[model samples]
Structure formats: C-alpha cells, structure tokens
Target chain A: SIIRILEERTEPKRDLEGKKVLVTAGPTQETIDPVRFFTNHSSGKMGYAVAEAAAKRGADVTLVSGPSQLTTPFGVKRIDVTSAQDMLDQVLIVYGEQDIVIKAAAVADYRPVQTFDSKVKKQDGNLSIEMERTTDILLTLGQRKQHQFLVGFAAETNDAVAYGKGKLERKHLDAICVNTVGKTGAGFQSDTNEVIYLNREGKEQHLPSDTKKQIAHRILDEIVEDMEADRK
Target chain B: SIIRILEERTEPKRDLEGKKVLVTAGPTQETIDPVRFFTNHSSGKMGYAVAEAAAKRGADVTLVSGPSQLTTPFGVKRIDVTSAQDMLDQVLIVYGEQDIVIKAAAVADYRPVQTFDSKVKKQDGNLSIEMERTTDILLTLGQRKQHQFLVGFAAETNDAVAYGKGKLERKHLDAICVNTVGKTGAGFQSDTNEVIYLNREGKEQHLPSDTKKQIAHRILDEIVEDMEADRK
Candidate 1:
C-alpha cells in the first residue's frame, strides 16, 4: 500500500527529469572593508528548501548561494558568492540554457562604491558609508529571457499586493512572491513562510504559512501547470 | 564626518517606538503521525527579518513563530507555535488593539484530519493521510481589521500582476508585496529578494533585488506613509 501511494504521489505528471533549474541563495555582502561588511538577515533557508524540492522532483538543479551556514541539498550543484555583483556574475554564467531560474538570494541593492584595503576603525559616534546601486538581476534576466520562466520577489511592509503587481508588470515576471516584514516570524532567517500565489489570469491562491519545502513543491507545481497552460 | 553623514541619512520619519506590532511566521505541521508529519518549505525568514527590523525601529513587537531555529531579535517578544490552528489562536490573542498587523506567516492550507499519536509503521505497501482546510488568517483579519494596517503577500508564478491586484481588492489589504518564485535567487530562503509594492489606489513601485533588511525598511517607511495618507 505504501509503495502504491508513493508511486501515485511521486509519479511525474510532467517530464521534469533532466530539466535544468538554477537557484540563487543567501545574503549578499556589500563590502565596506575587508573585515567589516554589509549584509542581511537571510540564512538561505528558503532557497535551499526550494533546491531540495526541485531535486526531489527529479530536476537538475544548480544553486548559487551567498555565504551562510546552510548546507547544500543533496544532488544539487552549488555555487557560492558574497556580493550582489558576484551573484549576478555567477547567475549569468550558470543561467545559460536553463529551463527554470529561481532568484531566491537576498542580494544587496546598494554596495559601498569603494572598498578600503584595511578595516575602517570605529572612531567616535557613528559611520556613514557611501552606497551605490547594484545590478538588477531580475530585469537583466527578464530582458534576456527567451523561453524560460522569470520570477521575482516583492518584500514589502505596506501595499504589498499592489507593489507586487507593479513589479510583475515592470519586470515582465511570470509570477512573484510577496512578504511583509517588521513583524515576527515571517521573513529573513526563519523556517516557514505564509504567502499568497498570484497568477497572470488574476487568480489569487492564498497558501497558509507552511514549511519552505512544501511551499517550494506547491510553487513548482504551479509553475509546471502554468508552463503547460502557456503551451496550450 | 561619518557621524554627520550618518545622521543626515537617518532622517527620522515615523516613530513606532511604543507601537505594538503583531507578526506570524513559519509553516504549520499537519501531523500524519508522531514521527511522520507534513510540512512546507517556509523558513520564517521574511517574518523574522521584519520582526528584527521593527525592533531596531523601536517598536514593541510580538512575534508568533512556527517551528524555526532563528534566534529572537533583541527587544522582541516571541511566541512559538506548530500548527496553523495554533498560530491562529495565538494571533487572535495578540492581534486585538495592535497598531499594525503583518500576516507574514505562511499558514498551511490544509491539515491532517486525524493525527496519529504514534508513528505509523511501514507495514503496508502504501500509506495515506487525510487532510482538511486550515483557517484563512488574512481573510478573517481583513474582515475584522479595524484601524490597524493589514498587509498580505502575493507569491505568484503566473499572472502575477493581475492576481496581486485582485488580492489587494478582494482582501481589503492596505498593500501587498508580489514576488515570483520561478526565477533564480528571488524568493524563499535566498538572502536577497526583489519585490514590488502595490497600494489600495493601484499605484505600484518596483524595488530591485536587495537585502531583506533594506527591503524591510522601505516597506515600513511605506506603511508609515500610507498610515499618514489614510489619516488625512
């Protein structure tokens, strides 16, 4: 009975085996100095969860991660980088000819323009670091997206759905995941997430907060379904 | 000079110092048995990141978390939970009289109808677990939302903009964040996330991929702005 059930559940509805999937994870470090740097609260849990889920679904996966304590999931190729620029470089290099690309890394939007060879000493009261915008990886991929799926994230505290929708249009993304911060257990380095799935046809599916692995499966299922519908 | 520059950059906008903010994070475990359980890939990073950011902004925060290894940020009241129903119960107790409610926790859409107290051994060839729908936290909150700002997330893989806008209208959310999961390095456990903000008025803003902290700050700033605008 168990084998039958497993077979039924694990049976591939779509031929995802051998499909190339790429992912990016962890927080990008914007260097202020060699010792002191700017990063975020991302621990690479969500990205790793998705990578694991994809691998379980029998897809070939390449995970590009920033520095974090998370271990690489089994059967997935892993790449490590530090800054957003580094992430962008690695993504471009690996993203070629992939059927799917998941940009789950929390890349820094701005980085210190100049890197000091030595650590900047903490002087008196406070410190100010001149910052400049990093490359827009999603937009770049969107511009170059040929036959692959393009997705982005909109993490907001206010007007989340409205902002997410705007990003979907502006970046030409097939879908987007929106989350709110400044609360308790929803964002950054936690082990679960609650999100709503918004599709191009205006269908909104509200997924209750669940583990990243389950969410990843649901997300991939949706993607596969959407791709099929697109073909149809 | 650094302190001066830092001060110039840190212009005080809206103070949430004494405000009570409630948040939910992580996925609920629908137990199949004591040892075997069903869950998702939620790392609770987004919610936790938001909580840390809020605490940094001097807000008195209450974080309701599912199973996660994340350490509570300094100056935050944390509550641990497991199932969606448990999260809902905790949220109800804390949500009332709060200044803002960010439903960032990804509650499971379904739970096992009956959970086995002991681990179900693999005696048969297959096993099945019955599931039932969990509570709709956002919809319920939207219905009961009084003066508090209510925000939701829309994670869509297709028709992202349309679905996000629909959620904004249907759920009476103050705002929503939309993100796509199919892209590389954008959603879930990645350290960097790119998102879009959408308001009740349908106005949208695009935030390219960045650290969750910066995105959290921007989201909170927008929330304050929206609050002020609503008051007017």
Candidate 2:
C-alpha cells in the first residue's frame, strides 16, 4: 500500500478545477445466458487511475464502468454497467453535460444474437453461437460532440500508432491515446503503460513505461495544453 | 469483518484430522482469442468455503482454483488454473493421494474450437463461434477413483434434484450436491445456498438457505457420517 501510494503522483495540479469529465472503463460482458458470457481482458486499472487523478485535481468526474473488482475512487461518481449497450445508454444520458469525455473501456465489438432465458443445457455434438455487432460508443460520442473534448483509446497488437490515428480521424476525436497490447507489463491488467498521445493538430507525445497513475496525469496535462492552445 | 466472523462456524472439529482433501473452485475461462474469452458465473465462493472448512477441521487441503478474487484459506495450498483442461491436468496429478475430492468449480462444458494467435479483428458481418465439449473432470475421476470419496456439485435452473441424481449415477460419484440457480439469494455468486445433498445409498439431506461456510461444514459432516458407517 505504501509503495503504491509512493508510486502515485503526489502533487495535485488542480488544473482541471470545476471541469465536468466522464470516463468509461473496464471490459463489457455480453451475456450468452444466465450462466455464461463473453468478455475481454480490460482490467479497468488505467481508467480508474484517470478518474482518480481527475477527481483529485478538482474535476467533477463521473466513471461509467463495466464489471470491475476495483474500488470506487474517492470523490468520483461511478455508474456500473454490464453490456456494451447498457454502457452506451448511460454514457449518452450524461454526454451533453460533460466538458471532457474519455473512452478508455474495451467494449465488446460483438454480442450473442440470442440470449437464452435459462442456462442452455449441454447438448450432443458441437455448438455454435451467433453474435452480432454492438453499437460503437466512442463513434456515437464523437459524432454528437458539440463543445466536449473527446478522446479515444486504441489498444492494438501491431502498428499501434497508425491504427490509433485512423481511429482518431474516423471517430472525429480531438485526440487518441495509442498503446500496444500483447506486450509484457505494458497493457491490459498491468500497472504500467507505454502510450503515444496524438492529437488532431498532428502533435505527438510519447510517454515511456510508467505507472498508470503517473501516465494519467501526463495525459491530462497534454489535454489541458491542447485545450488552452485551441482557446487562443 | 466482525459480522462475517460472527456468522462463520466458530467451533473447530477435528473430525477430518490428517485427511487429505482436494477442492476445485471458481469459473474456468476458455479463450476465444488473445483479447476475448468465454466464461461462466461461478464465483468460487462455495468451493473456497469448502476448502477453508476442510483445513480448519485439520485436513490437509489443496485448493485447485480457476480465476477467483478470493484469498486462499489459512493453511490451505492453492494452485491457480485458467481453462478447464488446465484444471483437469492439475487435479489428476494429485488425485490419488487425496482421501476426499470435491468438484465445486463450474468448469466450462464447451470451449471455442479455435483460438486465434492475435485479437480477431472486427468484420462487417456477424460472427459465429464454433465450440466443442470439454472433458468432464468428475466423470474421469469417478472412472479412475480408488479409495477417494468423490463428490460433485450440480448448479441447475430446473429439475435440479433429478439432474443432480442422474449426474451422481452416471458419473459414479459417492455423493452429489445440487442447488438451484437463478434464485434471488441462492447458487452462483451468492454467499448463501439451498442445497440437496444426495448420496449413492439413496440417502437425501436438504440443507436450507445458509451461508456457504456453514453448508460446507454440514456437507463434510454428512460425508464423515457415511464414511464411518462404511467402516462399520
């Protein structure tokens, strides 16, 4: 506990004071039935850190999270959601009022087309489950952006920055944070992250391997800098 | 903490002194790809309780667990596992030395036929996952059992008793514990359970809604009783 506290950014910036921020985190579960579901490897750690950092810096943070074991960060409002659709519904309800939005969640791209009422009993021979696309939360948020500073995260296995830039342009996001997954100690479920923050203005900042908490603070600093430049 | 401590069985029984007990707990995850997986709703609470109770009763316990957040009970040896196949391998390695074995983990009945090396990129159309049956750990154990008192757990939505009995007979288990899922306060992820413990000798015991810890003790008591009778 002491080491974790020490590892965290101790000096609060208060730079985001009075700002309304919303962040979505964790991996959404798509239920196949009462007993079974499909899920991904997002651990919600990075997003939780961001929410905590923002809250500590005096921003009113609302964390719309999927199923996660992490405790609620103090002073941050949290809304728990299960499926990707459920998350989108909640995020949309509060989207208009937020000054900043971060889509850090690894939402399921597909969900089972048919969810059974009861546990599907084991049948003879092989089984096949039909799945369809879930609504893209970030894309919807980007399309509807008015004054909100929207940011998206792209976790890729290869050509991370290129894919992230493509997502940034396609989703109409102000900025996108790109990170390589499948690397040891750098992605999903890890405390450390190696990220490249790229903005619409072609500004790129590479943050080397660091604690997620520290990285969150640095990312916020970049967002603040970009917002200030846009105002001028 | 005080409330939980007060609710647990306080008196320690040495009824299982020097006996070797092995328990399998939690929900096994079957990876569909690097990012996505299929899993059930088993929280491993019941199995962990059984392990804790067994250890407290002076038994040497080995807890072979799937992905669970619960901590290992005092004096219990824990072996973490992921998929159903991994669980089976770990269990079979130590099965012969165990005096009692409890199948409490909700091992996935099916697994994806193919797992991709990397994350499966989203396509324009819907996706269908082909799945095949996983080996039944309990059935395999029963077929190879020597002096071990084998027990199995059946969590079902309908005809729980009948299904559990059939499993007991078909698997050649010494006893089977059946509990109805989808109830408000019982079965998966719940601290309380309403169980029907049935043995091969046609003896039936109804354990009303109670904390998993207390129910575990009762089940052990029944096993001990039956075991003593056999000795006579």
Candidate 3:
C-alpha cells in the first residue's frame, strides 16, 4: 500500500539526505505534588510519525517527546521532557540548527502556581490549586525563527478556519494544519487524521483521512514543495 | 490537572450528564492485500479525550473507534471498526439516537478499488492500484440530522479558516474544529492541543496550548452552553 501511494504521489520525492528536522511530541506533565501531576492525553504518535517520515526521507530527525507509551520510530533521536518549560528549553537547544521544526506536543497551558512536596489527602472538604499560564511556544519560535520553515497546529472546535487564519498571521508560520475537535475521528490520538494544509500564501489543500505515516509523508511533501517554490 | 481544569471551567459540570453523545476515532484501514493495508497516523486521542470528558460529566457516551493501540476510556461504550464503510454504517446506526455527534475520526476519503485476498508479490517492477472515494459521513449525517448538534473537523494546511467555514456550511455543522499541521506542539498524537472554537454564528474562541482533555472539556462546555441558549 505504501509502495502504491509512493507511485501515485505526483510530487517528486525531495531528497533530504542532510536536512535536519526537529519535532516535539506527547503531553507535558505539570507537577502538582510528588505523587500527582497535570498532563494531557497525547500519545506522541503524530510527532513520532513525523520524525519517522523525516528519517525515511533521509533527514536528520530529532524528536523531543513528553510522557507517552509509544516507542520511538527507527533511526530517530528521542528526548523526553515533562513540562512545557522543559519542552521550551529543549526546543531552544536545537531550534537554531534545524532546517525544519514541527511542534506536535500538547504542552500544558498552565501549571500549578505552587507544587506541593507531598500529595494532599482527599478529605470531605473541597480542594483547589491555583494555576499560572505557560509560555507560548509557537509565538516565541515565530519571533526567533530565521530561514527555517515553521509550521503550527490549530485545534479548533468552532470557527476552526477563522481562528487558524488568525494564528497563521499572528504566528508568522510558513504553514499550519487545522484539526477540528468537533469531529469524532480526526484529531488527537486517533490513528488516522484528516487535515487541510494552509500555507503562508493562503493556498489550501485538503488531505483525506489516512494513517499518520501517510499523512506525514503528504505533509512533508508539501513542505518540500513549498521550500522548492521559495527557492525558485 | 483534570480536577484543576474542571474546577476552573467556566461552565458547570453535569451539564451534559444526560446528554446523548456520539464520538468517532482512529483511522480506517484500506486493504491493498491480505498482508498489507493502508491507514493513517490518527491514534484517536483527541476524540477519546472528548469522549472521556463527556463521560466524566455524566453523558451517555458511545465511542465509535477505528484501529488504535490506546485503551478505551472507562464508562464509555466502545465500538471498533476498520475501513470507512464500517465507520459510516456505525455512525448512521447510532447518530439518530444521540443528541450530539462529534466526527473526529479521520475517515478515508478514498479506498482501494480492489482488495486482493492474497499478498501481491513484487513480481513486476511497477504495479498500479485503482482508487475510489469513500462515503462522506459528515455530510450524510448533516442531511438527515434533525435536532441533534453536529460538529465536523476541517484539517487544513492553507486558508484554514476559510476552508473550515466552508466545511461548516457544506456539512451543516453546528461547529467545526480547525487544526493546522506542522506546528511545534499540537495536533495529531500530541497530548497538548491549541485550538480555536468556531461556532455557526461566526464567534471564535481561542484556546491556547493545553491538554486535549482540557480542550475537550472546554469544547463540551461551549456545546452545552450553546444548547442551553437555543432552549432559552
């Protein structure tokens, strides 16, 4: 099936023998106590798939992952982090050298204002934890981004497209992939993803649902094509 | 983080306790042969998170899942399937009985025109496989839907909002989640997601980087609020 799709892909496979691709995956864990933490449901499948796809194309791939049970794809470097701050720090270390950067991790938006050394015992009374906002990784990357291509994700439930467009403008991304959460099978941990590709030029391409591997291929294909067009 | 987010949620919990919710997840595998098949990277994380969130709020949840490695969330009735046709059949069977349907699975837009029972050996240097379009599940549901709230996902790489809005109208969805690919830390398998909720009324709400679970809760909150407003 892969061979068949490869054969049918009209776009020529762009060689990335020496290109460096960096990706982030999984959900960051924000600690609330020694025994408890805050996190998301990300399984790091999409980011790992992207890394694998990049490796398949002969690119040097580095994947910075959060907490997830999935194994690393073959021929890719993996780094694990637990919090959004940690993820941001790791990304900064490699961001400068990469030719491409894809952020697929669902970093926590906020963290416990104070981490308790011990877990709070459950009592009959109610308990509360104050939260503080985490850093904006996309915006920060966009601010520091150089010649490298940057892509961002906008997961929307309502007016998905409009908000995605806003992000594209605000983040100064080369392309953005929008997924609607309102749909049952398309986003998050689903093995299949159906997405539309939006480029900086406002061109739109809709990718039908397929495996993350195939979707990753198509996404990279678009990125390579966009790069080639930029070069021209 | 779950308890913190739940406490912080602007809307009350239990709002969807009795609400009948339907969700779809994972990628439909298209068979090329008995030994090989085609699928995507969707792990069904986002949809599953939403299902779990709805269940937490006491909704009667029915999750229609495609192939995925993740375990089913507790208290959520699960139905597994492969291929787009199987998904369509399940959705049609269950959608009518539900009050809300979230189409999150990345349904395949195309499938193999022919499925060979035996593996096709690499006999010739080149082989061609015919392709055919799968059913448009969202559109079909939208057409027959009466009082049920429908949501669709627009995964775009370009013109994210315009395309998303187009999909919302085309599918007659109450709302749509738009997500862009190639971002640093959101979408697909990542646990943390950043999305904008877009409603039919053109109102957009931005959700910064957070866990898919939190995002799911926010989405459900909005949906419940919208439903409440409609009743008023």
Candidate 4:
C-alpha cells in the first residue's frame, strides 16, 4: 500500500518502476599518508540530488557516495566510500545490472604512488607527492555499457561546451553535464549549479542556473524521454 | 543604536574592539586549463566560524575567502579570492596591521606548470598535469610576523599531534590548530570538528568534537589569551 502510494504520486507517464539506476557522488580521496590525503572540492550535492530524483521517480536507486555529511535519500541504497579505489570497488559491483548510470564524483586524476603507512615527515625543503594516474572510472564504465544510459559530469572553468562535448565523445557516454566551477553562485560548494547537457546525438541543451535539486529532476526527465524514444 | 545593541550583546569582558583580525578560508584553485583547475575540499567552515565569532565580539575582522558560497559574516569585511597567489596578495596587504592572523585556507601545494589557454584535449592514453610548487603562504607569514599572533591549520589523518607540532615549529607559527581530516563528521564538509592546539611554547591542548561555531569561539578565546599573555 505504501509502495503503491509512492508509485502513484510519481505519475505513471514518468514512472521508472522497473528501472535500476546507479549513481556516484562526491570526491574520491587519494591518500598521501595515514593522516593526509589529496581531494577536490566536490560536495556531492549534485550526485545525491540525481539519485534522490531517480528514486522519487520510482527507480530502484543505488548511490555510491564519498565521505560527506549528507543524509541518505529515502528509498535509495547507499554505499559509503573513501578513496577512488574504494569507489571503484563499490560501483563495479552493481554497474552491470543498472539500466542507467550517472557519475558525478570529482575523482582525483592522480594519487600519491607512495602511500606512507605513517605520517609523512615534513622535510626542510619543498615536499612533493609523486602522483600516478588513477583508474578512469567513467572511461571503464563507458567501455562496458550495453543497454545502460551512461552519464558523466565535466567540470570546467572555461570553454564548458567544447570540453563537455569532447568528454561525451571520448568516454562513449549517452550524455554529459558540463559546468564551469569557481564562478559566483555556481559549482563546488554552491547550492545552485548551471550546466549544459550534450548528448551522443550531438544535441546540446543549456539548463539555466537553478538549485541542484531542480537540475537533478531536469536531467532525469531528459533520460526518461530518451529511453522512451529508444523503445519505439 | 544597532552597533550599541551588538556591542551590548557581546559581553564587554570578551570584547576585542579596536583589534584588527585577518582570517583566510576556503580552498585555493590551481589552474590546469582555462576551464579546469586543481582544488581541495575545504568548505572554509572553521575559518568562517572564527571570522564570524571575532566580528561578533567587536573585532574589526577581515576575511580573505577563496571561492565559496558562504554568506559574508556580519561586521566582517570579506575579500573574495580564487588562487594561492590571490590569497597571498590579500594577506600581505594587511599583514602588518593585523593583531591576529589565521591561515585557514587549504592552499594548493602545487599548480600546473603549463596552463593551457583553452580546453586541454583528452588524449587516448593517460593525461598528466605537470605541477610546480606554489608560494608557501604560511611560512612566509611566519617569517614576516612581528607583533601579529599568527595561526595556522594543519589537516592530518594520522599522527596529528606530532605532525601538527612539527609544522608549528618549522613554520614558526605562534599557534597551530591540528585536526585529522577524512574522518566522519570531522573535516572538509562536516559542520563539526575535533582539533588539537599547539602554541609557540610547545603547549598542547585538545578540543573535542563540537559545532564549528562553538569551536570557532574556543579558538578565538585561545588567541585572545595568548595575545594578552604576550602583551605582558
């Protein structure tokens, strides 16, 4: 009865009752020492929003989140994670079974190759962390996608469209949301975000700045539309 | 009248009127491309909380914040910044005049040596951002401090006390707030924090987990005590 009430309120036309969705949010830390790590300013707000929106639309949602203070969305399965490797482990487990996948995590590009078990002693001179390339989770997911509608986020400070499109093509993603970070009232640490969506068919739709929750719903709407068209 | 009301609310015994305080908060961005940059997940809560507390206590507070969505604290003059160089310029401008200086911004240790004017093209293989050391803002401030009570933040995940003390000594800081980040509700995105304080005399004090606002007031209290101690 409770499930029926939730499903009914979601509206049958936009219902995703049978769909399985997987989403990733936040920043994956790259440990330098037992007490120190390299991480980016990803608040995980957008990813959680997307996950919440999908779950509300009746999709069975699995959220793989990095360390954040956000409470889990209702009716969504959550997997807490820390490092990039930790994220990969959790995501790969449920990725193959999902009908849709969205990766919004700002994964660290490089990590300290030498992870000190103890504290890294401060030297007299400039200290450097020798970094090595981390596994490209999106790229890997891109390669494995068959029936899934895969989405990725590209955070740029300049040329948002060009970079977003490039990532869309290179990663074999169904769609990509591109936004410039560090602008006033936009990106990382902000409640609102402005993003441009680029699809595999070379179509671009610019979504005006809005709360991350609103944007999340908009993105999900597009995915629903695309999935419906494909079925025909 | 409003000034008087604010003044009356802030207990006269704790008043820092006529005192000049400077605080740095948020994460400094390091440019990689015109559209991309490297940054850390520093929410600037602790720094902002400190600035807010000092301002409420009648201090003429100047908050130099990196890119963040936080609202400016009342009675505090806010200076927005983006990169490490940007932070340094602002801090240096008023360093000589400040009675207290708190370096809470998570400044990027290194920046891409070569910054692409446009979007950096994604290649078939791994992409590497060659990084070079940025200015050590804290170390420079420590060297330059004469009458100012300089404070710094050391975010560690392990050996917090030892590493924090080491940083305090090497940087010649008047005091340092050392905390282990990457733990649940501890650092970066959390509203609460647990920290250990180390002063120039090698004295150590531990602060239990509490709201950033409470912790901020505690930090200000310690700075006030030490400044008063130094006056005699």
By lDDT, the best candidate is 2
Query: What DockQ does each prediction reach against the true complex?
Result: 0.01, 0.63, 0.01, 0.12
Winning candidate number (TM-score): 2
| lDDT for each candidate structure | 0.73, 0.92, 0.78, 0.82
Please report, as a residue range, the 10-residue window in candidate 1 chain A with the lowest summed lDDT: A119-128
Q: How high is the DockQ of candidate 4?
A: 0.12
Residue clash pairs of candidate 4? A35-B157, A35-B158, A157-B35, A158-B35
The alpha-carbon lDDT assigned to residue B196 of candidate 1 equals 85
TM-score of chain A, model number 1: 0.90
Model 2 TM-score?
0.96
Give TM-scores of chain A for all candidates. 0.90, 0.95, 0.91, 0.92
**Per-residue alpha-carbon lDDT of model 1 for B72-142, expressed as tens digits?**
87888999998788888888887878888877776766565776543333332323334566777887888
- A-chain TM-score, model 3: 0.91
What DockQ does candidate 2 score? Answer: 0.63
Score every model by TM-score. Answer: 0.49, 0.96, 0.50, 0.73
Tens digit per residue, CA lDDT, model 2, A1-232:
9977764646777999999999999999999888999998899999999999899889999999999999999999999999999999999999999999998999999999999877889987899999999999999998999999999999988788999999999999999999889833136989998799999999989988899988998899999999999999
Candidate 4 global lDDT: 0.82
User: How well does candidate 4 match the true structure, expressed as C-alpha RMSD?
Assistant: 6.4
